[model samples]
Target: MIEKAKDLYAQLIHAQELVDNSTRRKVLIDSMRELEASGVNCQSCTGCCCTFISNSMQTDGVQTLELYIYLHDKEMWNDSLISRLNEVIKNNRLDYEISTGQGSSFRRTYTCPFYNSGPKGCSISPESKPFGCLAFNALGKGVSAGENCTSNIEVLKQREDIFENNEQRANVYLKSILSLDWDKLPMPVALLRLHESIGKIL
Candidate 1:
């Protein structure tokens, strides 16, 4: 499973031109840079966005594979990570599926396993982090629900436009690796399922 994910990552890197020249991605990056310059960023406050309080951060197979490879390279793909993911799922009832009508079902939200409650913030690098994570940013100078933070829907839409096709292809490839049929899933659940595919007991 790891090897297959690596192969996919390699293929993505090989075709990096689209990513490099994507105008939508450039706009999103520029917006982030502007926020940083204006001192409107997530710094001192706790990671409310990463928690299940109001977060439902979902990721497709491509985003999951990016994070998986990043963790493996950083020596973070170990028993500790597995345990954290499992605990998050069990504690928050993330395994339970809710019917969204029209024969669609979705999993519950939970704190992301990669969220380090420290200065480092997210364990995953910006490049490997999910688009939803990236687009959720601070809107003001300090913490406040109304003006302090929110998800930039426009930025998220821009990124989705740029990578939608890649996400579709990745989900198709990943279906052969795991028994799951979900195209996009809660971040922790997806990662845990992928790790379990290798039969490595937590």
Candidate 2:
């Protein structure tokens, strides 16, 4: 699984021209920093945005693959990580599909397993973090609670369009291997599914 993931990561890094041009990613991170400077103090506050009470972070296959590779590199992919994912799915009813009335179903909110109360607040890197998480930002000064924060929808759309315009090759490749047919899924569910599929290979 590790080798397979590493190979995929390297392939995508080259294919996506990530090393030469990570402009979109850089812009997203820069925007987040600007928002933080405007008084979005997430560093020292309780992570309300990451809790199941409000979190509904979703990701496509490409994002899930990036996260999987990151976890593997960090040596965070293990039995304990799998257990946490399974527990989150079961405890939060993340597997229950609620119809969206648009020919699709949406999973319930999931508390991010990597939402550590540590200094970083979240354990995942910005590179692998869900776009939904990256786009969400505090709206104004002195806003600690996530209530005042909202997604920079314009930025989110721009980033998403870039991937889609490229035919989402990475996402399609992931689905070919993992049989992940859905366009988007709760982050934990996507990660678990990706992990399960990788475990089956070789």
Candidate 3:
């Protein structure tokens, strides 16, 4: 399992490198426009399946929520927040949901429920999981993936269209996905499914 995890990690790094190349994202909207023409459905891409999410120790609220589930199931959480998260889950409360960041992006009202503000740690999701952990399709060169992100289908497809060459696209795509370091974040609604995924994986 660890070897499998390492392989997954390597794949993520390759994608991250692509994203960091700048040559791919430098074109900005032109790439997006090209992908928009590709007939790919963001909702159906599922590239995120190869991805997982991780957080630093300071993340809280939704971040902690997700972490708690991860810790408890994986037995990774110490005597820290698991008990508290359990209480929250039992009570259907979200006190862990605190306001993070300032703007909608940094402080976007949404965060993963498993995020832990106190320790700032993340409970890693499994690889066979669906795609959010892998990719994000934010507009422009402004967006960046963090850790454990697989690769956004939209972004990967856009790489192909913009490069217009399979070999180059594949290389660039690998770099882009690795650039995120699997740091791509999964949207909230998608996060809601983690509990079930954990159940299946654990």
Query: Highest lDDT: which candidate?
Result: 2
Cα displacement (angstroms), candidate 1, residue 74, comes to 0.4
**Global local distance difference test of model 3:** 0.35
Error of 2 at 5 (Å): 1.4
Error of 3 at 47 (Å): 20
Candidate 2 weakest ten by summed lDDT: 16-25
Better of 1 and 3 by lDDT: 1
lDDT of 1 by residue, 1-202 (tens): 6676676556654543224223324556678779989987777667777767657777776677678878888989888888887898789877788899998776576777877774447877676777767777888787544246787998778777877676566557556555556777788888877666644321
**How large is the C-alpha RMSD of every model relative to the true structure?**
3.8, 2.5, 16.1
Better of 2 and 3 by TM-score: 2
Candidate 2: tens digits of C-alpha lDDT, residues 1-202: 7788677657666775433124546667888988777766576556788888789888787778778888988989889998998899899998888899978776577679999864468988887787778887777665555667788989877776765544377667667766666778888888887777777777
Best by TM-score: 2
| lDDT of model 1, residue 139 | 80
Candidate order (lDDT) = 2, 1, 3
Q: Considering only N, C-alpha and C atoms within 3 Å, which residue pairs clash in candidate 2?
A: none
TM-scores, all candidates, are 0.82, 0.87, 0.23
lDDT scores in order: 0.70, 0.75, 0.35
